[model samples]
Target chain A: MQTVIDAHNISKVYNPDTIPVHAVNSVHLHLNRGEFTALVGPSGSGKTTLLNIIGGLDAPTEGQVVINGINISELKPNQLINFRLHNIGFVFQAFNLIPVLTASENVEFIMLLQKRPKAERTRRVHELLASVGLSDKLNVRPSQLSGGQQQRVAVARALASRPQFILADEPTANLDSHSAATLLDIMEKMNREEAITFLFSTHDQRVIDRARRVITLVDGRIENDSAATQIRH
Target chain B: MLLKLAWRNIWRNRNRSLITMSAIASAVLLAVATVSLQQGVWEHLIKNLVSLYTGYAQVHAKGYWDEQTLENSFEIDKTVEQQVAGTPGVNAIAHRLESFALASSGDKTRGCLVVGINPAEEENLTRLSAKIQSGSMLESGQDGALVAEGLAEKLNLALGDTLVLLTQGYYGSTAAMKTPIRGLLHFGSPELNNQIAYIPIQLAQYWLDAPDRATSLVVGLEQAEDLPAVARSLKKSLPKTYEALTWKEMMPEINQHIEADSAGMYIMLGVLYMLISFGIFSTLLMMLAERQREFGMLNALGMQPWSIARVVLAETVFLTLCGSLAGLLLSYPLVWYLAENPIQLGGDMAEIYEKFGFEAIFPATVKAKIFVEQTLVVLSVGLVLAVYPVWRVLRLNAVEAMRN
Candidate 1:
């Protein structure tokens, strides 16, 4: 029942060439503390735009975004960076892992950004990689790992900071179906067990089926919000 | 952790790092070495000039220094020597007599400056004894005179040859003294080489009709910088009638010459710094551009804009310190090896240097100040040049950077 992310009539207009384009229009959503929500829309339907605003990566033209009792619109750049470092973790469609870092190093990176102690970061990295089934690939770079393994590392990284909210923008878009399903299972398990909120922007049925609550987006507006009671347990 | 990340990141593009370092090192090498050599040559030239002409400083009757004439002259005695030697920082003091005299040898006569000095004390102040190539310096007060080498050659004289000296001595007194040419000595400057002559202080006093009197006391010191301080102390310590002057104050023409030379060097150093600064700034600019995506992600990952600037500055500081020290170190042996065996300037340069009376060999001697000054200049300029990229990185938009 706890609202982790609350939006009020948020709209984003971008000026690409001195002419305004409505990227997202009059959108509203609320994510509970333990919710796994899916935002289903076609390409360019402003799914990423809404996700970016909620993640505090962007500012909308005419609305306020509130997360964890603080309105992000009120924060300056440095405060915003502090908020992101302490309270948010992100996993992107292409993995977005720094290619130069190894598997565990990529996961340990968030802990580093937090300026956590080295020994604690190492231990946490070990535990997270193990949890993601990548204990053996800890020292392997992204090029040396499979798609599913790299995505798992990203997932571990997203969970590294132990944030109340996680944002995944088409995380499984580049994975094989088997890898996709496997990753979805890991995300769902983390969502339910740890009470970590997750919001994914996906058109894939696999990702949609794995969500407890699904919101269908069309042309930058949410058309429907539905909940399914298909707990596979 | 910051240092660790910075170090590791530098090694990622080894070629780029090497190029940047090499640019810095070569810059330091050229600038520092050039400065060290120029300073060395300047010291050598001043040493020779001071030894040959006015000693390091002089003490004369008040108003006599500003206007050199017979009217302002004073007598020399044990009291003057005792007073000058009693002053602090006065290494040596010798009595001297100077007059404009006409010298005639078989009707070929020229106007010349005739100097009278105590042979023993003058030896401590100037290299007058060693400059005597043809005959002995006046060892005994009874006999012999030291004439200019060029003048002696023009007069067709050798050791023990006598020349007639005619002059209006002190108080409009007409006097003449038959003197034997004891030796011939060369001066550092061409004009002095042509027309100056030296004699025993008593003998010159006798010829000038002011027997036991001198025009001034030539004083010498251990170092050039000590000259002004000693001059000040002498001014306060000595009688009110006498004044003290350093070589720089006494010789305004030479001071102006050196000042003009150094001003030109300043303009040249500005050019060199611009070249090096551009080299460093260009390399850093390219590096920032190449690593745009990485910097964007670092910002996204919670590294603040200030932290990014610190990282870049750290890179430049490290590079500047290492390169400057390495260049200075390597240049030591290079310059020492070169100074010990100088490079000869052949053809036109050889002819030119010889014509100007400078040595044909270009030798470089290192000074501790040259190293410190050149290093400070390069580091400060490089840091200033670093401002461009640091500002660019701080103002860079994160999303646009990620797309870069």
Candidate 2:
């Protein structure tokens, strides 16, 4: 299987007066293409830190993270931004969409940044919004949307650019079980049907059960890597 | 889209936006009023002063005004009248004969300066003919004369009373003429206003035994704005024996008063700009600080630093444009109305202005430079202040911003 994300012995440290606090100590991670993976852990397990590092959002004290054969850590600051723009998408725990942009425009932001033709951006934005079942709410700002709807909009925005890999950090933590299950199903369908990789950092058992493969972490190290049972309809 | 977003964002916090906008509007209004009032008052003072003293601009016989004497008097034929009146910005030009003379009413004699003005064109230039308080102007080619109130009182001369005016004419000639004081004229100032008499140009010329001759041309301008330009142009085209001087050049004291007044106004305007700058800068800084998290969310959503900076600049530019334009629109009509009917100061205020030699009522006038300069200064201040907020946002770390 082609590797969508590969990190080797990644470590993150916070130094206070030259004394290091190891946030992620000697962490190694990998997510294959078309995989629906969960990084399950307790509080302070550094799962989110590892995900952030692999998503090209944060630099590690020591490591090499290659996403789709490109050495992300070796990229310059502006190149990393461009790399992230075309390759990796992130759905943060807070569903951080710009409050001023409409649900559709939020999804179209990356397209706008890429300077895509207006017609194509419009078409792709509408398609993504419809995929997330937000077609009727394109003009509504994020503040007016519900928590689940906002998260779905974030998912649509993450998938808007047709990125190969997507990372979700505690996406279902703030959602009700019904919305969480529906969101997991939507992500799973996109992952399997489109061969896109999905990575999540969470403690939600429902999210873990829905993910096809689970990577469990404890104390910044993977304790178990196993396949999840198929979700009962 | 960025502009639309910026516009929506500005109105998002209506109170803050309104506060900032109101501050800008009021500042602009105050600036307009200040400029118009100063310009209007100064122009009125100049015009009134010209009517009172030098008649806008004066044309003298070669060196007669530079060195006043009977010897310097030159012939005032139709040629001089045509030349003086043909000069650009010379709305009305007239000849005058100013000479030292003695006035006596039965042994009550006084030394006086007598000015002989052309009665035909003097009405437009000096308007002194209408100010004859006792009787009338020189009537219908009559050699009848007008005397200053103080000159009449000192000479004990009443209307229709006769007095002897004696002077040395051309070539050390002894000249004397007995003429009736047809009118008594009141003047504005205590200083030279009541020490002179006005007679018809021909009458004074004949009396001084220099027939068909006069001293200078008293010219009025069509527009004071063109005074300096007209003076320079006229100076270039002048006959070597003559000089063209605007009212400002003619009277050093009045020019000093205008410069001193403008200097004070400039200081006040500088202070006003500083005050407005502080108010606007603090408001923008506060808005920036309070919206750090909001901006962070925007950055996290992948808005480029340039995009963020652009949005802020657009908002500020829009705000200033709307505010300044509104201020200008409102001030135009206000100044127009004020110019038509000037404000009147009462009681002590009136007395103070009179003591200071300014009119009690202040007038307002529109000046084109006021609009252009006010815009440049205000926008420069705004553009300078915009740098702080943009730099602050650029220095922000996304993680720290989100954490905050």
Candidate 3:
């Protein structure tokens, strides 16, 4: 397994000079390729905050994040955006698919931004949407789809970029129990068969039970890691 | 793809987009109509002043404008007539001899300008026959006169009434004649109505005792815009002893009035544009606020700020185009109708305009450039208002926007 993400001494403080709140304080972690992991914590435990920093959506006040041996924290704003476009996939908590685009169009958007050829973009959009069991919803806009279907389209869009890893911030937060189980099954199958990496933040016990590895956070600090308890491959 | 997305996004909230588009269309319509009407009024003013007396241009003896005496008048020989008649844009030419005279009817007398004109040529240029309120138009070689309505009233004179005209003729000779008023002419111009009296060219020469002599040759063109080129051509073609003057040089007061009036109208139009810009800016601000979370999602999905800005700008461009084109199309029939049937001024407004020698009506122009220039102005206002959305997108904080 390859080491896909490495974080060292990450700290994020809000309003540091006056009545500061440490959102993610001095945390260090690593995620490997093909791993299905969950960052479990109560509310305000900084699980989402840490995930945001690792995904390059927010900057850490201290320390650095490395992805595929590159120091992502050192990149400039424009370069960081390009790097994220190529290397990081994000699944927001709200099923944030663009509402105006059809499922296939939403899935093809990132590839278009990458300037992929028309034939390749079409082929990849079909393949990704079909793999997510959304072949029938290809021409349906997000407004016309259910929450579970929209989330599936979002996952297809995330995979379109062929990023090194995916960071899902509570991907099942808006789904029912049945939908959540189906989504988790799809994600687990992708991890096992395609060897794609997924790191999610959730407080749901069902997600924790299905994860191959779990990291717990308390008060912006990593309390425990399953990797430390098991032998290295 | 981005543009297609933007196109769909605006239609997502159909009511909001339609309302904004209506506001833009209404603004464009009003602004265009206002500008067209103002320009039309100015053009009409110049046309009326020119055709009422001075035609498009005039060919005069070199020193006629400086000195009004009979010595400054010139002989209209065969060469001079042929030279002017062959000029390209010269639609018609009227020979005239103008001089100060005194008219009296039963002890009431007033000083007036006595103008001699070739009836057929003057009718072709100024449509003098149309201004005849009573009796018939003057004819060539007729010894009768056409007295203005106001001057007729001042002298207690009527059609067919004989009036005595007295003036000093060529070489200090006494010139006086009595002639019946063949027609009563009514003019919109106060100055002309109060003092002008027209008679046949032959009679004027016979009375002034200066035969075959005229002070100026008034040349009418096919269109008013051809005045400059035709004036230039005539100035070059005519003999050095004569000078050609366009309406602009002939009536500096009218030119000055048009310039001053247009400046004021432009200021009003500037204020109109500002109001329209603010209306568009308000709508754009609302659009930005409504799409905050969506913009944040896009940014979090690895989309650049400039890309988001481009999408927003594309949406604005689409809206402006739809609104502006519709407004322009709607304005066509309205402008055309108003141009053909001008709105009449009523009550004191008519009196005020008549007092200044202007017609009492508001007319619109159907010129192509008026529509084109107005569309560009409104589109520019839309573009200027787009800056708000672009700025908001460029500086958007993904986390904050998503949270909101």
Candidate 4:
């Protein structure tokens, strides 16, 4: 499989000069195309920090994160944002769909930022919403939708720009069991059918069970890798 | 897309947006109304003062204004008169041969200013006929004099009474006459009312033994704004021995008073603008605080910081534009009403204003320039205040902001 993300010795320290606290420490990881992976840890185990560094949302102080052969760690803030727009997708724990935009508009927004043609954006938005089973909720705003439905819209938005991978940080944390299961089913369907990579940081057992591979983190460092032939220090 | 986002974002907090817009609208209304009234009062004062006697512009011999003697007077030939009449903005020109004289009527003798005027031209230039309190207006080529009401009362002379004027003529000649008072002219200024004595130009020329000589040619303009250009053109077109001056140049005291009053008004306006700035800045701060997470999410989703700033700036522009439009809509009718039905002052205020030769009424002007100027100023203040949000967005950290 083609390696879509390659993170080497990544470390994120909150404050280096005074009262330094290591949020992520010398973490090395790799993710391949079409993989459904879960990064699992207890609270404050640096899972979200590592996910942020990998998703280009936060810069790692010690190492490089190369996504699709470009070292995003070395990119400027604007360039990093551009690279993320064209390459990475994100789903926050709160299902961060724009509150004002409707379901279809929320999904179409990413493609608009990518400067895609209207016809193409419309077609892709319809396809992605249908794939996530939200075809009837096109005009409904996030405030009018259920927690599970908003998350599905977020998923469609993530896939709207045709990025190399999607980064979801505890996406099911705010959902009920049935809604979480439904979301997992849709994500699994997309992962299998479209061959899209998904990397999620979660404390939820359902997500870990559904993920094909699991990586465990403890105290700002990776302690176990289910897919690695040998353990990483 | 950014514009749509900005438009939607502003309406998301409708009450906050409305409050902010209201503040801006109120500021614009107050500013426009205040400036309109100030300008209106000054315009009315100038119109009254100029129309009472002095025209908008004056032409004289180079040293005529400096020296009051008959030797400084100039002769106005037909060519010079035609040239002045043909000037673009010159509405009317009235010639005056002015001198100081002693008026004696039945043992009531007083020092007075003797002004010679062409009846038709003076009527057209200053509407002198409108100021008549008693008797009839002077006819062209008439030999009668128009005495000031106060001067008439001081000399104990009524209309149709004969008044004696005594003065030295040109080249040390004796100038004396006993002319019948044709009218009693009332003036707003006590000084002018107490000292003026008007006679026909031909009669004054004969009395002073200086034929065809005029001390000043008062020029009226079609509009007040044309004063400077008309004065300049007159100066350039006239002979080298003559100079043309605008009313402001001839009456520097009034000009200085207006300048000082304008400076005080500007300081007040500056304070008003500062308050307006704070109002706008507070709104911006609230908007940024409320949308911190959304901005972070947008940054994480691939929108550039400058793009986010542009959206915020667009929001401010829209709010300010809407507010300014509202202000203009509300102020226009109020100003128009005030202009049509001016506010009258009674009692001591009226007395003080009358003492200074100005009316005590307050009015507002409805000029398109005032609307455009106040709107632009409010818009500029809003845009300047928008810098705060833009700067904040530029330095935003997605991780921390999202956490907040």
Which candidate has the top score in TM-score? 4
Determine the C-alpha RMSD for candidate 4 after optimal superposition of all C-alphas: 2.8
Q: Lowest summed-lDDT stretch of 10 residues in model 3 chain B?
A: B43-52
Each candidate's B-chain TM-score, in sequence, is 0.89, 0.83, 0.87, 0.93
- Candidate 1: segments with Cα more than 4 A from true spot: A16-18, A93-113, A125-160, A172-193, A202-209, A227-233, B76-90, B102-111, B130-137, B140-142, B181-192, B227-240, B343-361
Shift of residue A89 alpha carbon in model 2, Å: 3.1
Off by over 4 Å in 2: A1-3, A6-9, A42-56, A64-79, A216-233, B51-93, B99-114, B119-198, B208-215, B218-220, B237-240, B368-372
- The Cα error of candidate 4 at residue B301, in Å, is 0.4
Query: Which prediction has more favorable DockQ, 3 or 4?
Result: 4
Candidate 3 ranges beyond 4 A from true positions: A227-233, B59-95, B104-110, B118-124, B127-164, B179-194, B200-206, B209-213, B217-250, B346-348
- Alpha-carbon TM-score of each model against the true structure: 0.86, 0.84, 0.87, 0.93
Instruction: Name the better of 2 and 3 by lDDT.
Output: 3
Candidate 1 lDDT over residue span A7-52, tens digit each: 9899989995699888888998888899998988788888988988
| lDDT at residue B26 of model 2 (Cα atoms) | 75
Candidate numbers, best DockQ first, in rank order = 4, 3, 1, 2
TM-score of chain B taken alone, candidate 3: 0.87
The residue pairs in collision within model 1 are none
**Candidate 1 docking class:** acceptable
Q: Write the per-residue lDDT of candidate 3 for residues B1-404, one digit (tens) a residue.
A: 99999899778788877877787777778877887888888777766678879888888999787677889999986788778877887888889988899998999999999999999989988999999999998889988999999999999999999978999996679899999999999886777888999999999999999999999899888887777778888888888999888888888888888889888878987887787677677778888998899898888788999999999998888887777888888888888888999888989999998888888878899999988888888788788889888998999888788988
* Higher-scoring candidate on DockQ, 1 or 2: 1
| Winner of 1 and 2 under TM-score | 1
Per-residue lDDT of A1-233 in model 3, one digit per residue for the tens? Answer: 69999999999999999999998889999888999898988899999889989988899999899999999899988788888889988887789888889999999999998899999999999998888899899999998998988888889999999999989989998999988888888888888999999999997777787888889899999988885235122
Give lDDT tens digits, candidate 2, residues B1-404.
78877787777778877777777777777888888988888777776667655777776667776678877777765765687678777788777887889988898888988878777778877787767897877754577788888788888889999978898986678889888889988764433444678778778877887787777777777876666766776677767767666677778888898799889988988898888788778877876877787676566545666788888888777767666777777777887888898988889988777676666778898887887678777778788889988898777565567667
